[model samples]
Target: MYAAGLLNYSEHPMKVIIDTDAGVDDAVALFLALAAHKDPKCPFEIIGITCVLGNTGVDNVCRNVFTVLDSTGVSNIPVFRGADTPLVQPFIRGESPFFGVDGFGGVHSLPNIPVVKQERTLEKESAPLALVRLAREFQGELTVVALGPCTNLGIAINIDPNFVKNVKELYIMGGNSHGVGNIRPCVEFNFFVDPESAFVVLSAAWNQKIVMVPLETCKLAMSSMEWRKQVLGTIKSSCSISLKKGLLQRFEKDYGSWCSCDAVCMAVLLKPSIISKSSTNYCTVELQGAHTRGQVVVDHPQKTGKPHNVTIIEQIQLAELERMLLSTFHPSTFI
Candidate 1:
């Protein structure tokens, strides 16, 4: 796959921009990214973080991102605010039920944690436009890790036709591989919230891999809450400690089974080998049917002669995930 003089990624730091809606798990993903960035051996460098509407309103998401950064003592990465609403509909008002009222399990209200608003961010630049600018600046060296609805990314593609070409790759955490839905009968939450944008991002010809860690694949991380609360909770590290604060309410809510949907995406990004099984298929979001809107329709039969647009991860190694989680939560175990 080497073209003439193209430099290998190992030769330079692979630039990454995290586009997220700061839910509880989104905070976990950010903690993982921050840990990787601190490592000297890691090949990727986080350039910036973008906010979009998803688990909560865009404004809340932006604030929540700052909260994570503040909690982790990271001040360099610039947070860019993006689309407050989906492509077709206005964003849902008020906080979501999953991540408590404040999206971080009301962590900001905790006495130990200070209220952190949008700080140390590029307020002038919009998120979608920022994505376009970053892609051109980094050229083929940039990877966009999407952790929420595809609204911001879709707008970026619409902004610049060359966006997909300039960017090296995309890693998304959304959709459902088995037609199982969290928000609707056949639709996943992120896609269900914004089907138009999901369809747009999936249909594009990126010239690089679009690795999607859908719901079914993500559910593989639901192994043991005991391991999470005890093993991982005992790990005394800045990242882990900070993440624990965000996950306080979650432990009681989803106690028996534990699954950080977005964190699985981060783990896959950190170590692709963890993906023991995957299927490269033509994947698209359904936007028309009354009950089927936002469902991910994968061409498993290979009837669509079109080139595969996305690599749908079917399974991951749970053992490998545990190893990566250790490294992510405790940076010293990066080996």
Candidate 2:
């Protein structure tokens, strides 16, 4: 079921750029991406990271990125700031943030974490422009892992139609596959924040491959409460320490399970072999409806007669997902 064209043994190192909102789960996923690169033979070679507004403001997002960099002892990757608002409307969070106002699980903005101004790691160029430039520069070999709203990428495509045309793959952790919603009824948080951008990005005519790890799949990837407290809580690295202290603040205990949605999506992408089921569908975001404004309108069963545009991960191995996430914290634990 893992036949969505991402595997290539000859292509040892896959070039990647992460677009995120720096949520707690995003932090976990970001660290996972960073730590995987520590392995000299790992397939992912992250080119850069782009920040957007989702879990918190873009400024806080930048600060959180720097915090992750500080924890990981990584400095080479450049970070870029992107759209603060959506394409057609402002992003109304509509509720209090689950990952705290700063999206670091309310470490209460621990003083040890370096501010963006202190490290000055953010690039002068904006994220949308950087995205377009990178896609053109990479010339069809760049994989974009978007862990937030599709605003930045949508803006990039609008700036240059060929931006999507030049990209190799896009892995997004957003939307609901079966009308199951997290933030609102029939809507997921990311797509709900920016439905217009979601509509644009998902509906656009693109030659590049798009793989979505939906909220549904992420739910299936959740770890049991025992596993979270015993296995994940026991790891003692900078990343793991951060995870226990701040990253899992509010989300650590939810329905007797730990659901790191973005990290689940990252694990699926990092180890595609864990994908036990997948489907090809023409998916689009609902732009207008009283109750279903941001719902992902996946055309199931060829009802639309449209060519399948995106590959949606339907099922995954929960045990394998745990292994990948555990390795992200303690690199040598798995192998």
Candidate 3:
């Protein structure tokens, strides 16, 4: 009983570093992780947040990150600014009408949400360097959840050749499968934003494990509009007043179905069983080609000589995922 208690104490609050571009969905992901920090079943203690350029510029990303933290009443999580552009690639800004300029769908700030004053200032160290230092500090237990372009991670790998191998694992929300793409005919937004960085991260050797939750997985695992309305309909009664108001503001301008894409990565970390189907494969990005420039080329080891370097998630349990997402937004509930 004593040994079991010790084990339970050590594992509940898993240490994590969230590297994101801080879009609307990334805000949802951050809130979910913060909520999980309070869960007894499978909590996540956020070590820090590293912001990179993707959905918006690094400045806007930083603001969005801090804004989410403030709204959630989380005061001590350090925020770090990362790479402003992809390595060896020129930045061609992709205008996301849904995400808007400020990266929170242009909603900026919501009233009625209690804002936590900044207690933890931005770290002096840059994102990539901080990642390297943190990996050494936590060694065998740090899990990095990347919700943006892979620039920061690729920089870390380049700076310290062993950086990739030192982390416990990487939960990446990028890439696509079956040649399906969200941004272009053959490219996902994250990989399209920075193909060179994506190539570096996917090609980097890892000592532990790497899980890629691509665009396809999110499309399949998204909460249907019916389910979203049914669950969010109870937000007023189920959640705290402040949290309810915050959710309402964020969801007010929704389209059909609400797929918290970035949040899916966090959910997978909180409950690994949500992923119903996955496979290990070697992935590389195309650096040239008018239409296929940023496309990801996934190669199966069984069919090719390349080594399988990443676990690509193809599908997840939809119903279970819906439950997890709902729980993620509810402060009283645990995923």
Candidate with maximal TM-score: 2
**By lDDT: ranked, best first:** 2, 1, 3
Task: In model 2, state the lDDT of residue 92.
Answer: 67
TM-score of each: 0.88, 0.90, 0.87
Clash count, predicted structure 3: 0
Could you tell which candidate, 2 or 3, scores higher by TM-score?
Answer: 2
Residues 1-335, candidate 1: write the lDDT tens digits: 21111211133466899999888889888877776675666677899999998888788898888877766667778889999889887645444467766566665534443433434655689999999999999998899999999999999999999999999999999999889887777788889888999999998889775999998887766757677777766766444434553565555565456777898898788767677899888889888989999999988888989888898888888876666666566634322
- Give candidate 2's whole-model lDDT: 0.80
Q: Candidate 1: what lDDT?
A: 0.78
Quick one: best lDDT, which candidate?
2
Give one digit per residue, the lDDT tens place, for model 3 in 46-141. 888999998889988998787777666666688998999889977777554346666665555545544455655678889999999998899878
Q: At residue 160, give the lDDT of candidate 3.
A: 92
Cα miss at 303, model 1 (Å)? 2.3
* Candidate 2 TM-score to native: 0.90
